[model samples]
Target: MSFAKWIGGALGWSFGGPIGAIIGLAIGSLIDGTAQQGGFLLGDGQTSRKQSRGTHNKRPNYGKQTQRSQTQSGDFEVSLLILASVVIKADGIQDQKELDFVRQQFVSMYGKERANHAFRLFKNISQQQIPTRKVCMQIKQMMDHSSRLQLVHFLFGIAKSDGIVVEVEVKQIYTICGYLGISSRDYESIKAMFYNSSDNAYKILEITKSASVDEIKKAYRKMAKKYHPDKVIHLGKEHQQGAEEKFRQVQKAYEQLQKERGF
Candidate 1:
């Protein structure tokens, strides 16, 4: 119900996001009272003029978290919540299944109690008119390529929870991928797991529409190594199954292409 639940490490919402311009505050713990601070704002509520003027006079120790390990999980959690909210809303209707899917993901990382609490904040996140660019920019700043790829995979699962990945969701995902700096091949590789279309083969192998036979062969070998299900075993069986699906697609696409091109 508060920005407190949305983030941990005491990184106040007001201090975490760009200030002066922030009109809302569900996660409003700004940096002592600076316009440069960005927070994990919860609702439209914002720091009043009095609070922004440094009534507390004490700043959070964002400086203490100089190492990546200290903030990786925190960053991933907040980023996932923001991006998932957009995917859930892509179809113009928020389905219960989509929400449950997201909660399941949280439950895997956090225990049941914490997952439920995060879900409540996620509901708040879903309703907010978040500046997609700004929030994602912060996330992009915190996460690396591996982290970003996992984010896209997790989102793909949510969009497919209702047994269909709608067009709007796909479009929104493409935009988010752009913001997250996910390569087109990487995006399509994940997308193939949920929605396979005419171009899926190229996507599976991370090739191009105009790829030649030799190029396709090389891409297949490379993709096989890259997406080997064993690579994601630590992510648990559920994620392993998803990885398996993608792995199978890469193989199937390879065989199909071989036949199509008489290779």
Candidate 2:
């Protein structure tokens, strides 16, 4: 499919906010040759024909009061592209490894054709100055909690792709977690997945080593429910592999705890 049609059909609520603006700029450079064909692009970077009618005249509602709708795979894809760019640049160096990781992950989740389209947009997005907080807040407002968690998981994968998650990258992801309304516990839970420490298992379970076996078991069940691949099933099967990775980590942590305590 054409890039314009893929974007036009894939996005939902994201076609109307700061994300929309970023996507608008990226597509501006991408589709200049096809501009006259009147694909998704319109005046001033507007992507949606329906939104341009009445919503375009009014200011975007970025407030917490705005009602969130079901997040589409395209919305998740766009958000991932923008945030991946932010995390990759957090350390002041755009390591090719990190870029390759992004491409590889996209190829794994989306087929080569779609991944190419996404990477093309990603390159354009990387050149601009993104207002990270605004973009994240928009995502926090519009995206479901499960999908948001998936985003954090994928980001940690990117930061770790270079073989070491730098301090700056950690701090950047932490700040993003805050803006995305992810709790400190949730942040640490996902963060532990990419690191090795004596207490990583506990962190993954969102608990402490001091907890009794019953508590550990309880935490395991809760976490298993939270990270289950089905939680993000609405996002489609392409995303299930990532969510399943998280779920497996939780099981590993629990099993490790069980063996240690012999319970």
Top candidate (lDDT): 2
Q: Give per-residue lDDT, candidate 1, residue 254.
A: 93
lDDT string, candidate 2, 107-129, tens digits: 89877766876788899999999
Q: Rate the local accuracy (lDDT) of all candidates.
A: 0.63, 0.84
Error of 1 at 107 (Å): 2.4
**How does model 1 fare in lDDT?**
0.63
- For residues 1-263, write the lDDT of model 1, one tens digit per residue: 23332222223232354321232243343422222334332211232222233321333333343222222333445567778988899888999999988888777656676576557657766777767776655555544555567678888889999898888999998998888778887997888866658877877788877999989989998888777776654333434554566678789999988887899
Worst 10 residues of 2 by lDDT: 40-49
How many steric clashes does model 1 contain? 24
Candidate 2, clashing residue pairs? none
Quote the RMSD, in angstroms, for model 1: 9.5
Candidate 1's C-alpha runs over 4 A off are 1-15, 18-24, 27-71, 208-214, 224-263
